[model samples]
Each structure stands twice: as C-alpha cells, then as structure tokens.
Target: MNRTIAIGDIHGGLKALIQLLKRIDLSPNDKLIFLGDYVDGWSDSANTITYLIELAKQNTCVFIRGNHDDLTEAWLRTGDLNEQWLQHGGQSSIDAYRNFTSEEIKEHLAFFKQMVNYYVDKENRLFVHAGFTNIRGVENEYHDTAFYWDRTLWEMALSLDDKIPTDHKFYPKRLLLFREIFIGHTPVTRIGEDKPVNMANVWNTDTGAAFKGKISAIEIKTKEIWQSDPVHELYPDEDGRN
Candidate 1:
C-alpha cells in the first residue's frame, strides 16, 4: 500500500534526515510531506536545501514553507539580515551559502518560492509548517504569516478537553475544519515529548532537531514512527540551535 509520511522540522540536520530516510526504507509509491524549516540551525543549511531539491526529483514530495524558510528566502533575495533570525538559527544558513555561485542561489530561491503554505489531502488531513489562524479554514486566513508563524491553533488543541465532543459548541471551530491537522514549527520537546504529540485533532511533529533532539517522521495511517539519532550526536562538533 502507498503510504503518506509527515516529517518534522529538519533545521538543516541533513545527516539526521538521511538516516531517518534510510530507516524509513522509502518507496517511490510513498508520499513524503515535509513540515519545513528546511534551513537554519545546523551547519549544513545550504546542503540540506540542495539535498531536498534533489530528493523531490525521485519521490513524491510536498514542501511546506516554515518561518525559517521564509526568513532565509528573504535574506537570500535581499541580502538584508534579520537579527532575530540570525540569533535563532539563520546565521548558519548564511554561512553555509557563502561559497555558492549566484546561479545556485537563484536555483535555491526558486525552490523556496515554490513551497506551499499549507496542503490538505483527499483524506482531509491538513499539513502545514505551522498553524493557520482562520477559524473558518486555511483559505480564509487573512495573514499569510500566520500560516508559518501561528502557535495559537496548537495551543488551543493542547488546552482542550479530549472528552469534549466535536459537536460541542465550545469545541474550537478551527479543529472542525479538517479530519486531522499535522504541524511542525513548535517543537514537541517543549512539552517533554521526544515524539509526535497529539492533542484534540492536531498532531505536532516537530521533535526539536534544531536543538538537542532527534528528527522524526510518522506514517499517518499506521501511526508508525521513525527517528534519527539525536541531531546533536549527528553533528557533535557544533552546537545546533541551542
């Protein structure tokens, strides 16, 4: 059977990504939906983007734009550094691209431009780098930034009572928009989970690979998970985003 897998934030941990993919034993028939933040954090940011671009050529892949991706694209296009972004993880990305040719930068910029803000499958599962604020649905979102920056949706899900019926008037209108929502952006490690966390109908896949955590992926239908060794272990010489 063809499987659909949702991957967590990578944050330029290409080694971890490679290991995770190997463990998954990828099939061309399977679909890989990446939750983004493809660049930043680790030392191989530029290399990670190159790897992903090539990976897409051999497999079914959906790339969602993450906040870091947006920031990196902006800097690559304008050469204007975002101080906050650099402090968080952007510096690594910039350094990684220092020796790249203008043509290569343009190619990578084009890839970033092609990323979608969010994707919904036939199964009514929502895949987004972060969360959408629209209570109505992603189509109705007024601010595009919310697609890659919003945390309220996940917060609401975490705050909910699992016993609350979907039909309950107090149940969030947003959660009703899809059968299930898979998100990245906010690391599950913040909640002490080194794996995906499901609350209400939202599943957070970010396992904090940017910091001292492993990269993760989940087969949506089977809920089977795969993870890499801790990203810190993969690149022990450097402090990731910590």
Candidate 2:
C-alpha cells in the first residue's frame, strides 16, 4: 500500500534530510509532503532545494511554503534582506545561494515561489507549513500571513488540558473541517520535548530540525514516525537556528 508521509521543517539540514528519506524508505507510489522551512539554518540551503528538485522526478512531493522560505524568496527578488531575515539563519541561506549561477538562482526562486501555502489531500488531511487563523480555508483567509505564520491555532490546542470535561470536545468546530491537520513552524522541542506533539486533532511535526533537535517525518495513516540524527551532530561547526 501507498503511504502519505508528512515531513517537518528542514531548515537547511541537508544531512538530516537525506538520512530522513533513507529511513522512510520511500516507495515508488508513496507521496512525500514537506511541511516547509526548508531553508535558513545549518547549511546546504541551496543544495537542499536542488536535491528536492531531483527527487521530485521519481516521487510525488508536496512542498509547502514556510515563513523562512518566504523571506528567502523575497531576498532573491529584491537582492536585499533585513536584519530580521538575516538574523534567523537567513544569512546562511544567502551564503548558500551566493555560489549559484543566475539561472540556478532563478530556478530555485521559482521553486520557492511556486510552493503552495496549504494543501488539502483527497482524505481532507490538511498539510500546512504553519497554523491557520480560521478554518474556512487558506485560499483567501490570511492568504499572506496565516498560512505560514499563525501560531494561535496550535497555541489554543496546547492551552487546553488534554482531558476535558466529559461532554466537551478538545477543540473548536472550525479546526474540525479536515480529517487531520499537520504543521511544522512550531518546533516541539521548544515546548519542552524533542518529538512531534499531537494535540486535539492537529500534529506539530517540527521537532526543531534546524536547531538541536531531529528532523521528523510521519506516515499520516499509520502515524509511524522516522527521525534523523540531531542536526547539531550533523553540522558541529555551524550555529543552527540557535
């Protein structure tokens, strides 16, 4: 049978990314959904995109745009970036891209530009880089910000006690539109854990792969998880999103 795998933020951890794919043992028919933030930490931000471009040739891949990716794309277009962008490992991305040719830069920029904000599979499994403000859909609702930046949705879930009153549902009705929701912007590691944290009906897969934690990937149907070694271990010389 085919598996629908949702991956967490990469943050330019190419070693982790490669190890993750190996661990998944992707099948020909399986689909890989990347939760984004593929650049701006560790190293190989440029090479990581190049690898994904090649991988897409043999397997179905869904790339969602994350805030970091948006910043990178903006930098590529204007040839300038602000401190906010550069501070959060964005300088690494600039360094990575600096070695590319004009055509390579355009190709990578186009790749980032074409990334979708959110994706709803046939099973109604919503895959997004970050949380959404409202559940109506991301096409127009918070089109520019919510899809790749909102955290309140996940915050609401985390705020509630796991065991609610017998008659009360764990979450609001708005988030129930999808059978399941997967996101990657919020690192579970920062929440006092280094693994994917599931709350209510949403799963936060970002295990801080760009920082000291590992990159994570989960098979949506079975919830089977696979992880790469700690990113810091892979690139000891670099300062990851720390």
Tens-place lDDT per residue, model 2, 33-123, is: 9999999997899999999988888899999999999989889999886899888889999889877999999888889878998899998
* Per-model CA lDDT versus the true structure: 0.94, 0.88
**Which tens-of-lDDT digit does each residue in 10-79 have in candidate 1?**
9999999999999999998989999989989999999999999999998999999999999999999999
Q: How many clashes does each candidate structure show, in the order listed? A: 0, 0
**So what's the TM-score on candidate 1?**
0.99
List all candidate RMSDs to the true structure.
Answer: 0.7, 1.8
The reply for model 2, stretches above 4 Å from the true place, is 165-171
For candidate 1, which ten residues in a row score worst on lDDT? 128-137
* Model 2 RMSD vs true structure: 1.8
TM-scores for every candidate against the unseen true structure: 0.99, 0.95
